[model samples]
Target: MPNIQFFALAESVCKKLNLPPIPFPVRKGRDEIIFNPQGVALDLLLDELEQYLIEKPEEKIFYKDAFSRLAAIEGIRLGEEGFHDHAAHYFELGLALDPANLALRSNYALSLQSAGRKEEAMRQYRFLLQQPVISGQCLVLIPAARLFLDCGDPVTAHQIVKHCASFMPVDNEFWDLFAEARQRCGIKRWMAPRQKQQEIMRQATAPDYKSAPTGKKKNFCPACGNRLKPGARFCGGCGHAL
Candidate 1:
């Protein structure tokens, strides 16, 4: 359910490319993201927080709430640990803080789908579709339709894309998305060079760009030439501020 940007960044990570990585939604409640975390560390933080929430149980957790931000941060870390259940826990916590939060809802839905609750995932997507004041972020819709197709209802999936094609913007990015949706719907002809370009763009902005070295000795941030290893005010040599 994350925006196209999130998936695109994930795809980039999957392909080991470096560019503008997709971002996890950061607008969730304070209980969602844990920034500048120190001695608590990643491993024990979630456990401790879970216990804390249990004993104190407050009302209306949202992005502004400290606990909610921490929960979001830990949730992302849990996801990286391949602990899908824990990941869902934090995502839900994030949603609890901000129910109408498209980012959390979308991501939680994807986690459900990935965890093999296909029907539940589709139900979430349907709910997202029914939002009358939705943003122009068609990324969530396109991917969900593909999921439906893979779940053995090409007819419904086809309808999904056909109805959404109008919502799609006029650009190569969306054209590629349509191409992919059509291909998922059994329109083999949509698999063309444009779609290939889209795939390339997806690869470009994936997560963990440094997982595989980019054949460069120095891992300077290409954007600002900032030396990445920390403890420096700027690039000691390039003067790019850290």
Candidate 2:
């Protein structure tokens, strides 16, 4: 299974945040497997390549260039469209090329979580959070905390957000998760100032933030009118694709 390969490669390197095995493991006689560049446009690939190289300069010398990152993007797009298995396949293909790609690994975990493979998803999250790099990265940490909440372990989530909250910008995306974590820990007596601060942060950062009348939701859900979380790709209330 790719899961075993993923974890094995991760363990071999002692779980560094960015370094997976250089020239990732492949089946015998397939070391020469060339990545075919198709599906995504070349211009888009090049554009993303420039951004990726800037963000992850360590990957500049890797084989196949930006194709692996492209594959990761495609995988995420597929997952958002409800084709999860296909998404996993794309992520696996991307990881095979660039095993160190954090985006590929984290999105793979998310796809697994969306498919109801929570344990497998947590395995990936555990590997990710072990690295200090992930602690300050809102993209990975928030989702991992959300997964912890979904698994009914808000205490862990609260701990994660608590540490991150100290250093992360107050106006950023961590507050909602922080609030949810606090609520889950049965901390009902929130200070008014903190509540006001959370609301201010939400208004400042939320893409869909809006005020609505009584009996109406600020965010719409087809299956249920649960207020959507910022940056959520799916509805939390009914598991509906957003």
Candidate 3:
């Protein structure tokens, strides 16, 4: 159980690290949970905690939980205050203790993006996307697609969403972003029927199907090689109506 001494120790640690005063949430009849601190460099603080844990090896689990939680809370606070670099630092501290914490990784990626570290942010997003737990969920994929869109790579964003959007459950947010990406990639609008959009995307992504050379005209639908009736507006084979 934490007490006044541990709280004082954490405050001193904060002072030593040149950070702002963190209000340690003291739970009644429980441990004094000291906030790791926001708005400061936490590398030193983490190092200190590590060294302390080394000396008192038996208390590792307790200290790790408390400190990692503290890091997340303070890191989020720092991010809210527009200190994105510091926030990222705190998130890294938390991740050191809980490497599999998706929340910390997500926040860390956002912090990196806000700090103008776009490449690092993309890397983090990719890592999240690769995790089995994400399972192509828009929670990570949409943000990653947005990053590509923001980077003037709408084609990539379109590519990311188009393939997955076909199979995933419909989400308004995902569709909205999908439409924005599609528009940037030269699609006229997102209000088109889902089937129509898929057809367009299929054509857009499909390999080039050349028409007859010279004066001759192709006699079939390029998408599925279905024989086309003259003046037909859609393909009967694969519904390749544009």
Write candidate 1's Cα lDDT for 1-242 as tens digits. Answer: 22111112245442442223323232224223333343224333334445444543562342124444555566666667777677777778767656777767777777777677788889888888787654345667667777877787766666666666776455565455556557666777664456678889988887764565466566675656656775555566666755
Which 10-residue window of candidate 3 scores lowest in summed lDDT? 25-34
For model 3, the stretches where C-alpha displacement exceeds 4 angstroms are 1-51, 54-62, 135-140, 152-156, 159-176, 183-189, 192-242
Listed in order, each prediction's TM-score against the native is: 0.47, 0.49, 0.51
lDDT by residue (tens digit), candidate 3, 66-163: 56766777688889999999999989877877788887888899889889999999888878877777655656667778898998889978877886
Best by lDDT: 3
- How many steric clashes does model 2 contain? 0
The list of candidate 2 runs beyond 4 A from truth reads 1-67, 167-176, 186-188, 192-242
The top-ranked prediction according to TM-score is 3
**What shift in Å separates residue 87 of candidate 1 from its native position after superposition?**
1.4
